[model samples]
Target: MRLRNYLLTSIILLTSLPVLAQYGSQKKADNLFNKFSFVSAAQVYHNLIEKDFNADYATRQLADSYAFMRNPDSAVVYYKKVVEQPNVPIAYYYNYAQALRGVKAYKESRVWLKRYKKAGGEINDEKFLKDSDFINSIFNAKQQYFLTDVNFNSKYSDFGAYEHDGHIYFASSRNTGVSTKHIYGWNEEPFLDIYVTDKSVNDSIIDHKSKLKGDINTIYHEGPITITKDGKTIFFSRNNFSKNVLGKDEEGMTNLKIYKASLIEDEWTNIEELPFNSNDFSNGHPALNNDGTKLYFASNMPDGFGGTDIYYVDINNDGSFGKPQNLGNVVNTDKNERFPFINNEGVLFFSSDGHPGLGLLDIFGTVSDKDNNIISVLNLGVPVNSSKDDFSFFMNEDGLSGYFASNRNGGIGSDDIYAYDRIPQLKIEGTITDITTNTPVPNAMVTLLDSNNKEIARLETDDDGNYEINIDRDTDYIINIKKDNYIEDTRQVSSKGLENKVRSITADFNLNRIVKKVTPITELYPIYFDFNKFDIRRDGTVELDRIVNLMMNTYPSMIIKIESHTDSRGSSKYNDKLSLDRANATYKYLVDKGVDPNRITEYKGYGEQKLTNDCDDTMDCTEEQHQANRRTQFIVIKME
Candidate 1:
């Protein structure tokens, strides 16, 4: 039995004789909901609440029905009550959060999102919360596209605009005025069908529109197609209907599939489902690469990272296929990601509710490397997206113009197709070099900040010391450059008044290298003692005072070791004792001059050894040469 029937039977068996009427009403409403007639089910559920009969269950079901109908305003009202009920399902918290976002209650949505996480909801809530500022950055981004609604929109749903061979093909639910027209129960709208029209001469007003010529437009839902460069083959999404029968899964729910059709004699014929279609899960919204060697689509197959993830299959030269590969976590999230469109430049554009956005679904563009690895995902920002479902993006080879769909306010229908022209990107490019050497400073950190000092982009310079970045027109930015052992540099730049004319700006930086000696010794006269004496002499005191000034004031954290030596004229045993006393005497002098005892790491004596010159007993050297051997040396061990 279906969940509705089982639930109804349970309610009937559990209820007493006094509440049969209430249970009877619930059974009727549950039947409508089970049949996918959400509009009718919502009305019945509302009636149950008005009569105060099992209002809690009625309210929860009512909210779900409205959500199925895509009416968040109505859903939020009942969902609020459902969530406040004791022991409500944890999923309801997530549902409530999404509903709040639909109404532009972002702050309230985040609050519920936190509650959902606290309730053990299994989403990457921590990352989502930490990226809240990133969402705000997208909202505050400059407008990139100029959008206007197309004139072909209808009072019902109309979206998914694709242009091929100077004509526009789209999906619509506009009534065909047929007496036997089928109605979709979920939204109470007519079944979607593929429609085509000539490209508007004025780019917005369509002279005429008609159903696509072919068997491709089924009585069931169909549309959102992609055509090859040769224009001979077309791939489109359709209900899982074949051989005059609608296919369903084990749970009695229909799923969508991608179908291929050939253009023969001005008619689309030989329609066939792709080999990957299944009754268990949906695979729809086909997109093609520029060369048509790869086909991309959205699916909800098992082990997917989200409700729906974008997958692509390689179309081999012999007309065979490769296994589908998921686009991975960088693009897919725990929410729906759909409508994959790859532009001529190989950039992927799709709509997602998963990524942080203004609200609902928003269009985003991908930046990939030469190996096709995604490096970054960029939100298209306002005018192309709003706090509503925006998707079905299609861009021309030039990339400066495109079309998209949205259900945002002021649309002529539930979803309307909008044409847009992208503004040319403004950029800043430059190199960083060392000031003294005039050489490139590779791998230097380059940061771009807005007028308010908020970071917009941060990257490292390439091997050539070159850095390039895109910026908004008519905005002020701060460029900061930094590298190790070099002084950081900052420069202010402005794109104001440049508008769409000037495309690039140059900003270079020259950093000064920090110069410091690494050796332990400081430049000073040698500290020499009298013959066989460890006491401080007048000449030795001069050098000792300089060492005290350096250790006590210049570098307080500096640690040094004292090494004392003696001339070869003294006995080895006698010289060792004299050198030891001299080393100790120097250590005591520095300590008495207010230097920390711990700063002197060691005091060592090397007698009649490590002579600077050949002044041993076998050679008769001058008195000055012997004095050099009696000197003390200070070796710095540590310095901060």
Candidate 2:
């Protein structure tokens, strides 16, 4: 978990694995990697593997280097080679999963993440593993938003689109751009610059795009702009390479800085760097407060909480800037916290690789208290944020619809800008308990079915017998509850007929025991065994599962006696054996399905002694009537 010591560990690994002179290249790579210069380190490690020296270990490190370097495409390539290998480091599973996500391989990512959670020891974060399942659940949960790629997106990487009034401004690395043709080492993509395009009309997007005019679109990376409501002042992120005054960090790489400029005479003028801009660390992704009194941005500056922290600064009345304050650990983790976007309601939306998520960086939202401290953070869930690099979330003035960036699968570009709008929301919940005892039935299956009787959501009850699921606003739903040994229960709970508002209601399921007070309820569902076979049929198992639930959970104190009956068509001795075999097979099935074996007091064949209808050999009865005579029934004999 402590990555600062990785350099020492890598150095020791290199020296012990091979002769110093033979693996000097690896040592150099280790040193570079220790300094967090992952791009160059990945190259060295890659070359070492190509030369057939330490290929196994280099494969893992190389993948990690690419991952730390923010080059998911390359990381995915190398990580796949070492992810399933034995004796590999545990962290590789997590990194491999994230790399897969960065490439929008969510299912594959989930497989590796499962491995990561299994391998978790000292690096265990239980919530992280739990949230992984939640990520999958979010797919079937209430979906209130839709996404589509805009037409102006480039084949390279086009994202971070924000709209002001009518026109939309964004960042792009289109090859057609002017000035610098430099390609960034990370991801091997062209440098980014600010670009402007008209907002899509009626969901119709166009390819009309051009670089933002003036010195703002410099040789270095730029864009992710936010404008004041007045449209007079604008803040944008750019590398400190403009005007030949490049500011590099300790790694000799240029750091990003926030710049402010004014719109005057039909052009951006008074371009000045923000006072908080530093050469030692990167700062970018500026978001202005609704009233322009505060500025929120991401930075890796000194004394910061993480790789990047969302910080806000005050704008004094005299136009002076206030001290930058960290948004704190609740929102900023040791991993990354980037792309801070504050909505009209003062809720902060940011992208984070630090929080519990599907994979890679996920969009998260948090609201601040009066002191600017984070109160709570929620993963934007799914669709709004996929299992990839979903960041740069922006909300239009409408607050219900907006745009964001995602490198998820099916994107036309490495990263594409997508427009989205909120769907509707409905919350449904209930409790599952026993009808006889009125006791909570923990871990009971609570399934939500649509009007068509198709299962839409399946959840389990907690210790308190509580379960919840989200649905669309105003929809009819059937809630089904099932637990071992208990009779299945189904209840109808409708969000329909409700007005435009959130609704929460409890729909408790009281399950009765299949064997109730010395009576065998053959009225529930009939179970019949085929001739010469004792195996439980599909329909039999369905009926038996409830019996198993009733005996094991709902009425553990009741002793059950299962009697198997047969039609008169079979011989007396043969019928007796056949019926007994049927009873025993059913008995084994209940036990195998988690019912207590001791709960079954007696199980025997009645042969033709107990017929439900006139299906004897001498009688003219239909096959259906004969089948009804051959049935399995359970009776409650005694209570413990």
Winner by TM-score: 1
lDDT of 2: 0.71
Writing each residue's lDDT as its tens digit, candidate 2 over 353-424 gives 998777899987663333545555667666887888999999765455789999999988899988886542
Q: What is the lDDT of residue 176 in candidate 2?
A: 67
lDDT (0-100) at residue 494 of candidate 2? 62
Alpha carbon lDDT at 492, candidate 1: 81
Q: What is the number of backbone collisions in each predicted candidate, taken in the order shown?
A: 0, 7
lDDT of 1 by residue, 338-413 (tens): 9999886566889999987779999987645435577556677778889999999998765667799999999988
RMSD of 1: 25.5
Query: Candidate 1: which stretches are off by over 4 Å?
Result: 1-140, 177-179, 201-209, 425-640
- Between which residue pairs do clashes occur in model 1? none
